[model samples]
Target: MPTPSLPHKPITVSIVSHGQLSLIQPLLGQLDRWCTDSIEKVVLTINIPETDLLGGMRWSFPVERIENPAPKGFGANHNAAFTRCATPWFLVLNPDIRLDGDVLAPLILQAGADSGLLTPRILEPGKSAPEAHRALITPVEILTRNRPGYAAPSVPSWIPGLFMLFRSATYAQIHGFDERFFMYGEDFDICARTQLAGWKLEVAEKLLARHEAQRASHASRRHLYWHVTSLLKVWTSRAFWRYVLQHGGR
Candidate 1:
């Protein structure tokens, strides 16, 4: 556990709400309570039109809202928000993520010169165990996931976008998430490119956050279609193969 560092506020958080303002409100409250000292401001993207519940609310840091004229994909929404970033750190946070304490301090303190992306251990609600980190993405890896004694790599090959904290320069160097990916596979794609560009993906294991999992693709046909198509795109991408060849798909 790290103490809150208030001398400098270096993080600019990016959160996109696809009509999940209810969830965003509470998440924003947690950030206000615990991370206000570390965060410069919050860039919230309202991907679809909704009631303006945040009109009179206040926080220690500024809350800049981007009301989209039309809905954009996950990468597009966050990429648009990045244009407003002026801090050293950029966080891509999910609306459902809840924090009990200051999670940003430890991550910021731990980031080395070569650290490109970092994340805290993500837990499901009421669970003590951390969520599984992902292995490298390939068609063969996907098809063989359920085989006997199959195991994901001990070191994560990719981090989910749900709670990625990026060095702003590293993100700019990698050119952010590929907009070609609409929703699902962009996380894996970005993580792969981040490592291929000679930067380390570090995890702050002592810090934790709870993710109230939405599991949207499970219930929505449209979302499921996007997930499948995005996986196909990742499997066919140059970045994926380059990572596999260079890193040996560890």
Candidate 2:
């Protein structure tokens, strides 16, 4: 029998959880099957120390759970997650995202220097901001995603962090997500930085994934504050305009 082919390097998968015990349980369950022999390592960061629900789950791959008693910002947590990763490719996944099939293998094979950032067609339940994938982060977009049906732009520039596959080198060139963004805007900031550094973002229209966003901001006043604050943080920053001018965005 011919020798089986092995991956050049294993892909690292990570998810930061903040009290999404219920939602993540199923997500991980689906991931258990999907990851199988393909994944090298899986790290699940428990932001809520009290909730170690993921600790009990039976993971298929070499999964590790980190306990963060005093959880930091979203980017900081992921950046922390990245420290333990030694893979050529890394996937920053959201806790609310569910996998229907294999999204990593295909995306990795298609991604390279020309397109280091690969995003899948994020199918959100209902009219839940599918337009987020094909957009440039702007004040209007920030408002529209939360409100829905407000005419999002057709141009594609950024991808949602719900499922972003990054080449390790490209991610390092952009220096990963900005630690400043606590809960939001990190996704937009990273994409902008990637574009500024001359890496193209590609969307896999056929490679589909599902997003089950709770819209916690809309439900809770605190998250709403963070959402609005992060929007302002991304747009008002000097880097935002620098990227705009360099990348030809208004």
Candidate 3:
């Protein structure tokens, strides 16, 4: 991918929140400071009803809150919000993530470099480093951690979706994320689509974000079940098999 000069327009940041009002407030503050006038808009898609807590919030950037009554899956909600985004680039962030200014600079730099799809190094909250080199969206990686006898492969076949930056034009061309995938596989699906479309995906090693993993998702068995089912769906997809073969799957 050819590196393009930074566009004059601000990048839009979109976040999908279920019931994480407490965590999101602070995350928004951090984004306001780091983003400043560079944030074209901050849109939050909430499954819960609109409330005073949302109203009282103010940031250095413009923020918009949209109420999603049907409560579709993560990918669907993001795709729905993308329909309203007008920026040249858009970032999809989880509500529970805590980001630093230094991390944001590198990510934006990388995004400007590729102008396709960019992902940041995600760390477990409070951890000094990343949880792993890469994450494979397969049962093997999920079922076991890297150990003496059972070491998960360091390089993943797919990129995790927790924090992804996308070129709005390319995303629109590919129809954004596949709404069919309620959660897990959407990241892989998008990466696969980008690859198939001859676009490049880059990892911003210098940028980092701390994720409070699955606090809300683990609250219910249904979420876990959906995540598992979604993984299975990806494994069965023809595109996934092609991805595996092209990447020399284990």
Q: Which candidate comes out best when scored by lDDT? A: 1
Name the runs in model 2 displaced over 4 angstroms: 1-9, 127-132, 142-155
CA lDDT, candidate 2, residue 48: 75
Q: Residue 122 in model 3: shift from native, Å?
A: 1.4
Best by TM-score: 1
Error of 2 at 20 (Å): 1.6
Clashing residue pairs found in predicted model 2:
none
Tell me each candidate's TM-score: 0.94, 0.88, 0.87
Q: Which residue pairs show collisions in model 1?
A: none
Give lDDT: candidate 1, residue 78. 94
Instruction: Kindly report which residue stretches of model 1 are placed more than 4 angstroms away from their true locations once superposed.
Output: 1-7, 143-148
Candidate 1 C-alpha lDDT tens digits along 1-250: 8764534899999999998999999998999999888999999999999887777999999999999999999999999999999999999999999999999978988888899999998998767799766778767777886678778677889888899999999999999999999999999999999999999999887789999999999999999999999999998999989998998767
164, model 3: CA deviation in Å? 0.6
Go through the candidates in order and give the clash count of each.
Answer: 0, 0, 0
RMSD (Cα, Å) for all candidates, in order, is 2.3, 3.2, 3.2
lDDT of 3 by residue, 1-250 (tens): 8965455544788887777777788888888777665677888888766444666667777788788777788788888888878987788888887877745445656554345787777888667878665554667666665555665445544567777888888788888888788867788888877766667777776677788886545777887787778888888887777767766664
The global C-alpha lDDT for each of the candidates, from Candidate 1 onward, is: 0.91, 0.77, 0.74
Rank order by TM-score, top first? 1, 2, 3
